[model samples]
Target: MTQPHHDGPRTSVRPRPAGDPAATAALTLGVEEEFLLLDPTTGESMPVADRVREALSGTAREQSRQEFRHSMVEMVTPVSPDLAALREHLVALRRAAARAADAVGARLVAVGATPVREAHRTVPDEPRYHDMSRRFGPVAHDPAVCGCHVHVGVPDRELAVQVCNHLRPWLPVVQALTTNSPLHDGRDTGHASWRSMQLERWPSIGPTPHFDSAADYDATVRDLIATGIMLDAAMVYWYARPSASYPTVEVRVGDVCPTVDDTVLVAGLVRALVATAVDEVRAGRPAPRIRDCLVAAAHWRAAHDGVDGDLVDLRTGRPRPAWDLVDDLLAALVPALRRHGDLDLVRREADRLRRDGTGATRQRRIMAGTGGDVRAVLDHLAAQTIAG
Candidate 1:
């Protein structure tokens, strides 16, 4: 099916003056991760999410739910005030989901997309899924991917709208760090994040638009809904948005990371970013005048190179090494990090991720060592998924 033509968001980014450094505070945060249910011996994805959910203990079941694909299940951490608590919650959830999948004779893997040789997973029996499948054909059927979503508490939707702009440039940086879907359908896709490529195929998925206020955001959303480009507000696939069900800013960008440490690292960065953005907004600073096409270009390249190649330096409009951008982002967030007691964690993990490389880098290394066997990649992913 041909997707409707909607040029992402044409809202003009207005220039804002540099203002005083405002107060920063650590925000309560949560994480939602999706995992693939695979046949342990065959390394093929299976439509067994319901069985895994049934096998989960009551508490674990409460923290988990089904994703778009029946071969996938998602687990969410409770609201956490610190990275330590976030790590504990994420680890427990990963273990619980892994144990449940094992009980149902499957392996749960934290992959952005299935490395299995086939794409045959089914959707759950739900009205939303049925509507999506009927409306979009294979576009809905073939999304065989999973992602990690982080929610950082904000005071209000208006503030969340403002913070979204502050987050625009940093989205690509985070994507570069968590590029897990380097291979798809048992073959190398060339792009470090094949999942990102598949997702942007949707008409509404891309950079978040600049908004004048919360009312402007709501009106634009209504206009887009009237265009029939999206089913509802929930379908707006911008990299960042105000939560529909909670008072928080949700950054739904990165892939499902391979381990609890990765999740915590991402959480620390996201929380620090949100906190930093909140400070900027309260200080009367306007959002940056970044072009939509430039943001799109950066995102595409980030998906292509992960952290191994150069990226467009938006500040200078020139190419720079990807890890340099990551470092600059870390440097910008130091104040927020210090306020949140995450300075040490962020510094240490940034060095480690840079040294160890991203998930895509690690997956590529595994393929090389195993003579390009996709099955071994899945095996390694399954092992790492719950190792924390």
Candidate 2:
């Protein structure tokens, strides 16, 4: 894609207002899930996206794209009116995607980070991924990571940028709670979500600053391009950004959870969080700093302990037990949860995770029983994908 002219003035282009009830109700939900292709029986990385794509061509309803192409594939569900519909679309699409993979002597596995990724690996060359690897060099070539992204539609571009900026502080919280990648190259990386550290190697990855308007956001994006650090706004790989082609802020921090229920709950939480931020901004309420800092600390804890460490209370900088922080986050998000009509689903999944722990916990347990056999772990991951 050709770069845009860089002559626009950099000025704040704030949205109409944040909390207008009219604006709040105008939001919509979408999801972008990444999957790994692997040998069905041996559970090793497999470049089967082409075959999967060929099988799904003219068959699947979701918009499937060759994401890092070959070893990884992504499917985007159409924007749904509510969380329930979003969940339904994703569930159906995942099932079909899995089936397509199965037909090609491969299986689809949903993961935050693949257990045995070699950063230097590349799939069969495709123009997009090829250009990406050429542009990013090592960061794009790294084959060990994957993630789950949620896109909530904003009524206007300015609102979308505001929502993305306000949502930054909490980005780390979502990262920590959804931290799932525990193994890399068949061994523990000692980080809950190794993917976060892996992505940090890219040029524009991490927490983003709040922008006053779409023009300000656009100007900031232009700066990244002029510096030659990224090819375009779409490549600005920050944890969140106003999607270049869509009227939404894509939340890119969460790890791919293991169960269908957890996926739904996480989706609900993301939608609610954005809605809440949009509302608070409209009300002229100061954005919450605790939410921002806690999110960063949460990423640190989750990376180190994988749901086993203490996360700081965003409000006081005091460390709180991980479980307690999870509880508090859920409680604070209740209003947003209710608005999405996903309060019950979020509660159910949160309760399950609280009692059983996140998917990483389960993967660890299975590995222990099988003597650190990653193939066994892959079995669990593959089974979980179908269950979704």
Candidate 3:
């Protein structure tokens, strides 16, 4: 189906800023991850969501968004104030999810990308997925890809948009650190993250411009809706956007991390970035204008080289080591890091990635040693699939 078109720019009515200290203090963290269920031996996709749901059975009530029709099952832990608690919750949730999958003759792999995905593995005859396949064609039907999405409560819409803009510079760094999908369709894609590149094909998907205020954002979303370019505000699908359902800014960069520690680290980084951005914006700080081409170029570099890429520092056009830039960000976020009590977790995981390399790197090593056999990579992924 062809998407609708937009004619011209629209006006925005900035919402009156109602800055509340209490609201900001109550900022909480929530995560939504999408994963693929696969046969442990074959590495082919498995349609065992129903069996997994039955496994969860009575426990489903405790987990939010449980019992999915797709081969994937998701869990949302209760809101937590610190990373330690969040870590524990995710660990337990993973175990429950894995146990559910195991009971149904399936296994869960928590990686950014699947090296091989059979299109036929898609949820059989599900209307929603069928409509999605029809709407996005092969993009939605591909059963190999998965992603990690982080949501941080902003309490204010204008602050959410500002957070989205400030987040632009650090996005590539996040992508590089979380790079996992180096192969697609049983072939090496030569890109650090094939998933990131693939998702960019959808309309209005990517980092958007900095809006003046919440009214400006609402007007733009209204225009997109008016033109029928999107079914609703939720369909904006930009890399970062003011979430339609929650009072939070959603960051859709990064692949699914292998460990709960890594997920917590990414979540902490996102929280710090959003908090810092809100402070700067509320204090009347002017944001640097990042040209669309420059942003796209940075994404390409991160996708191609992963940690090996010389990412352009948005603050400075000069190139720097991807690891070096992330270190700087971690240092700059020390205040928010302390606030969230996740500095140690973030630092440790970042150090681990910097030392051993990302999931993509390890997958490539296995493929090279095994003569481009996708099974070798899947074997490793399956071993890690048993939840922490």
Candidate 4:
């Protein structure tokens, strides 16, 4: 693999206000979501991402980019302090992507993995992705999987590392709530998020262990890269980690939600969680000491059953109803949510998801209604992807 170019160190010269800590360290948020492009009539995966990119050229070039597979594309939102504004930006971007797909005789579905498509044969014409394909073999070419990554600003690297440790246990809960991929290769995988399982094949992809300090985190990452297990910091696919390029901690647990409201809900919860963790560190509280093995088990359970069955509650390390665990997480983060003025919105959106079920459940229902027709599942996902 060719070494990536480095632009040298960036030194921030901005002045900081003297008085209020919260005012100085306000948490901003952003989201990156991936989608699969498919043939509109056949619901089969389409390698038309280049065409979609061409359609979005000059208008949303900064907002959208091609992914590793030609069947996939990713959109990223600019950082915003307001959740509503973030949702609006995401909606506009999704609409733009949908229009671009339409112009190319394709459709965009925002599920975690394409339901009917087998492994994507065509890799994007990029050096890094080509290296990944050559190194990882078939795992890199599997049915394109998508995810929703939330970045919450923590400017301070030490705080970001501490927040990553604090956020580790709760990741499974978030994953359960955002399970959007239950089918793979035209059949039910029985796992709520087969995408999670697929990603776990990579060495660096899962719950990260607790790091005592920022230095510790950096050393661990450097060691991993040195071993040839991964190529660079970008390949450290932990469920939550400090962003390599941005001054934020990125949470990469959740599946790409189909609905705008659901995506907003996940982003809001992620920001609140980061804010809450920052407060805990500021207050001199020690990070939670959950064992990494238990955390991995919780992640596995969430990926397997989603919110439909049981989850290993981190508080007790015992199996509990998934919704109960979700409620517990909300209650735990209430103070942060209230502080950010996102309490009401998060509550309402979460309640709606619980009432209607998550994307995985909806996909199953749609498939059942259409006598297990994968096209119906694709149609439902595409409709929900554009609905808000």
lDDT of each: 0.85, 0.73, 0.71, 0.85
Candidate 3 pairs with clashing backbones: none
- Candidate 1, residue 134: the lDDT equals 78
Please give the ranking of all candidate structures by TM-score, highest first, separated by commas: 1, 4, 2, 3
Tens digit of per-residue lDDT, candidate 4, span 247-363? 999999989998999999999999988987877666666677787788999999999999999999887899999999899999998988987889999999999998998899999
Candidate 1, residue 313: lDDT: 76
User: Per-residue alpha-carbon lDDT of model 2 for 1-388, expressed as tens digits?
Assistant: 1223445323233344645567558468888888888876666678777788888855363488866646777878888887678778778878888888888988888877878744437745667667777887867767657788888877566666667767755565677777778888888787888888788788677676555557766777888789888776668776777776787878888787776667777778888888887776566555543443455565666566655777766566677677777777788788888876778888887788878877777778888899998889888888887684
Number of clashes in model 1?
Answer: 0
TM-score to true structure, per model: 0.93, 0.89, 0.87, 0.93
Error of 3 at 277 (Å): 1.2
Which of the predicted structures, 1 or 2, would earn the higher TM-score when compared with the native? 1
Worst 10 residues of 1 by lDDT: 1-10
Runs in model 3 with CA error above 4 Å?
1-26, 58-69, 121-132
What does candidate 2 score in Cα RMSD to the true structure?
A: 4.3
lDDT of 1: 0.85
Per-model tally of clashing residue pairs: 0, 9, 0, 0
| Model 2 stretches astray by more than 4 angstroms | 1-20, 57-62, 117-120, 123-128, 288-298
